[model samples]
Target chain A: MNVRIDTYQQAVSRILRFDRVQRTAHWANALLFGILMLTALLLYFPGLSGIVGRRALVVNIHVWTGIALPVPLLISLLGPWGARMRRDLRRVNKWTRDEIAWLWALGRRAPRVVDKFNPGQKLNSLFVGGSIVVMLATGIVLKWFQFFPVSWRMGATFVHDVLAFAIFVVVIGHIIFALAHPESMRSMVKGWVTEGWAARHAPAWLREETGEMEEDQSVAHSD
Target chain B: MTTTAKGAPDQKAGVTIAVGRRVFLGMTALGLAGIVFGARLESVLDSGLQRLFPWWPGFRIYSISGSYPMISEAEYRLEISGLVDRPRVFTLADLKAMPSTSFSQEFQCVTGWTVPNVEWEGVKLSDILDEAGVRQGATALSFESYDGADSESLTLYQAQLPDVIVAYRMLGAPVTTEHGGPVRLYVGPMFGYKSLKWLSAIRVVDQVIPGYWEQNGYPLNGWRDGSTGPTDLALTGGVA
Candidate 1:
């Protein structure tokens, strides 16, 4: 009974980390990217293809899923409901000195205050956005191969193949990182995080969000 | 502002960036190995995996619409007309009754991927044109399919290539309906699209009339070697 009360108190102190638009877009990306990966695997591995022989259907699904990859995020960014996501986008695009320092201080655990989105997250989002555009363009050329020159087809195939492998690895890495930072994952999933968790990991953002600061000293932990 | 170099996520950030670097590098490495689809891949993949997984190189069945037109063997007729002394409507049995030419080669698609060693048997297109004697000025053969959407053409010279057959059998069996069967044109030297599936008509024309894919963006002469098809192949495979 005492533990339950403590848990309730902690929940009461939880911060709203992600808005509805942000959560929707994140989950949408997960679902679409999941489907794209599954279809892509079915298309790529010949052994796998034998088990499920309706390649035309699999290919159509993969292609349409790829074409639709950016829709949810694009929709989320366009509407009034996307206001918070837009603000977060600005934060993701901007780089703080500490974010840069955090990137450089790789091997050693150094002292730096964190923001809502770290530089690594920004890089990831950038790659995902850029790759979507590239993959779509190259994918079109692949489907309508007659229009372009053979060399363009070859180059597009090369780039598309390279980007696909890159996207797969990046997605895997993103999942691993998200799982590693369960508090962060919960923030994205439930749109909230425990105040203590945010305070520990993202002190500057916590202070900015809640307007709370320890006047005597920085709450930045020097690991 | 005071959020300066106050501190860092030395634990999560370091691990994240390190993993990020490896992922990027891994992609670069895999990319170096590279990927080439279609017949070009025959060198890299054909020997072992092709035997193990023959269906690895796939064929895309296409028509103007996303579907094919169904014409049973009994209902099918190939009309050979225009600028000819003897224009003939050949039933599947008629074409099969003629002395057949059978050969095995890759059915290469312009989009890449190849169906390899596809055994095709039918009378040579030239033999049919000889039977349906060409008029004085006829210079090209225009082909239309039963679907009425897909069409293709070859010049008089290309039409006479020894390897170009009006195929009735593929894969050692009667060509099935889904594969444009009963009787279809198969031009071995050119891309698979040149072989009109579910063939319905062959019109001998005075000049070239670009077919369906040609009306789109495909080169009218879709040589598998990526050159002027029969012109180059003429030295060996060409017949008068």
Candidate 2:
């Protein structure tokens, strides 16, 4: 068996490619977003809105936060970080033969070391994309009730709030996976992975980009 | 490209895979549709639910800085006094003597629901202030609601929004008792809080003092559209 050490520049560029900072910022926003939605739900109970004092303050904060929620996400998108993240996440998804085999042998084999994103990632991309759209549409409707009829506005509030809880669960899953896999977190945070890690996980990527092969043992030994 | 690959596309596995893809796509489409319905549904539910149950506080068109279970217009009279060279007590009819301005705009409650485009016809608060010839150094206006439901104060500076009118008509009809009828002050451009329904008296104050709601906890000036204030005034003041 042979393996090669991919160059530091090549490995670093590939890992550093996406707007990971924007991803972090987006995740950070989920906390406040959840708080706003939940409080709005609380205000819906009978005898609550006019309970006056803290309840009313909570209600006010909920509305103000709802109005403010989209601002950070919108600003992040206009920045370079947001644009690059959009570009990288849109990478055409292809499964190599080895990955196909991994899929076939799912229960029989240990999880494969992976480069970039795995199958679950593609699904997550879809989930987050769809989630954002739903949250944005429903959220604004709830926030700006005067823009629509009362019947329609009421419905928007219901949907906006229930979906917020759903997003909360999804975000938890995402964080758990990130923690369970330190390598994934490291790549995002540091924007680089050692050559050995790449050779084991993303051999094809390493080969394609560096014109080097794991078959080159001497280079691997040097690293 | 290989014999093994050809063999792998067997009937049972291929059928399952194709069915799985169909199911996945179907689920995605359903999810997308659900989200659309969800977004629209929340608003629809809020209004439909309100229409079904109009008596709910969030849906009630008759609430302002004061108490409820209010007095009738026959018994209701508005007194304009304090620092005005002349003090006068006028029945609801006297208020009708003044020219009125009416228009419809959204009335936003702090609790996240707004009744949109409420058509109101009433005297402009400005008309009354001008008639009273507000004395200089009268920095604030105090409002007294009939039925003694609410007594609230606002700064003259804050009361000057362009759409602030002392509304009398709602939706092309005379305002009903249930809707602050006989004559309610509709501060159109201000938050529903400032629109003090069941209004009965206007007093000019020398200083900007917080009134019933403001003193309790509500913001000093509740101008909807993201007003920064406490939830609402403590509900202890007399009727509106």
Candidate 3:
């Protein structure tokens, strides 16, 4: 009877929410972006720059960090180790009508159905991906301004500044959201979430994980 | 000073004023104090901090102009005039034919970027000044770029520094147009900006005339660490 009880408890225990590859990629991206932001600030502000000193070193850190920004993501998308990440990327890109409804119904009676990522998370991922590419291009132009035309350089400067400000705001928002959702934060770090937590927060994802039909919305609320 | 003298209400004595005499005097004194000491002290303190911690953070070049004027070697000419016996022009070839000195020194920007041990080769600025035979009362020299957008001035003493040169070659190659080359001024001891780019004309002046950057709040003595006499580019307004 005790062994049967233990087996039942194990069935309801922690289930893998993020694979090791996904966790690695996410953490690596976060760290690189954090360093890039810090170094960028030191380079941009005169007062801050004076405190930090060694501007060339700061520039190198910023440039090389930006260059390596996509490396983890790209690596995570390769090989059998990346299968889960690859599927999640597709799911994140494929927005269903319920996801849109969930976003619209936010702050009201919201839909209980959420996949591995909600609409907001998907949007954030898209934005972060697009920003990394744009920022890298503009940053390269800024670093090698002499190679480009003056007009192009000026435009790149303006875009880089505006996008950096936007990224700073979004990244802050991303951290805040992560902090607000304690289970989600733990899931990213630990590569798992308890079955009960997944059932509550990501019912459709839990069903998909359990080899159940993904199409049925009738029981979207697992609770 | 000329503008101040012209604009001074000092002579307008006792005309019915809104404020009381003491209040007026106080405000005037405060304003004058802010004018003279505030800017100068801020710059002095700022550069002082830099000297103490020469480790600057960031790489950027500051330029006042949007366009660069790149005159080719054929078109490039260095005109030496004003307070000179022989106010003559030296072609690029003429400059190249003259004795050239080569040395590697740190190219330090005022805005806090340094390209260290940059190899520069060119004619000594003093040699040309000597050739021109500066008039007895000449106290300073003015440099104008072919670009028409930039100008620089140095006291006669500063202009003749052993390392100050009219550089035609840099980094083992003919100076590129982007580096302000073909002919450019290289002032070794001071900030890189004092070394104006794009060789064009040099005019000896009676007093220090602030360059474009100077007029825009840069110290007249743009030494790396306030290493030279500021001597008040402020005082030279009337003389220039």
Instruction: Say which candidate scores most in TM-score.
Output: 1
> What are the lDDT scores of the predictions, listed in order?
0.73, 0.57, 0.70
lDDT of 2 at A206: 49
Best by lDDT: 1
User: What is each model's TM-score for chain A?
Assistant: 0.86, 0.58, 0.86
Docking class of 1: incorrect
Residue A212 C-alpha lDDT in model 1: 37
Enumerate the chain B TM-scores of all models: 0.83, 0.68, 0.70
Could you give the candidate ranking by DockQ, starting with the highest?
1, 2, 3
Model 3 residue B178 lDDT score = 60
For residues B78-196, what per-residue lDDT tens digits would candidate 3 score against the true structure? 99999999999999999989899999986765533355568999999999999999999899988998767678888898887789899999988998766787899988877766888
- Candidate 3 global lDDT: 0.70
- What ordering of candidates by TM-score runs from best to worst? 1, 3, 2
lDDT of 1 by residue, B5-64 (tens): 222332334322233344344544433333333224444555676577554445555544
| TM-score to true structure, per model | 0.64, 0.42, 0.49
- Winner by lDDT between candidate 2 and candidate 1: 1
Instruction: List, residue by residue over A1-223, the lDDT tens digit for candidate 2.
Output: 1233445456454544235566565555665667765674555543433333244356567767766665666666667657545433432133434444555786355334343455456545556555555555655554544454434444454455456656667767888987997776677666566556667666534444354344346544653
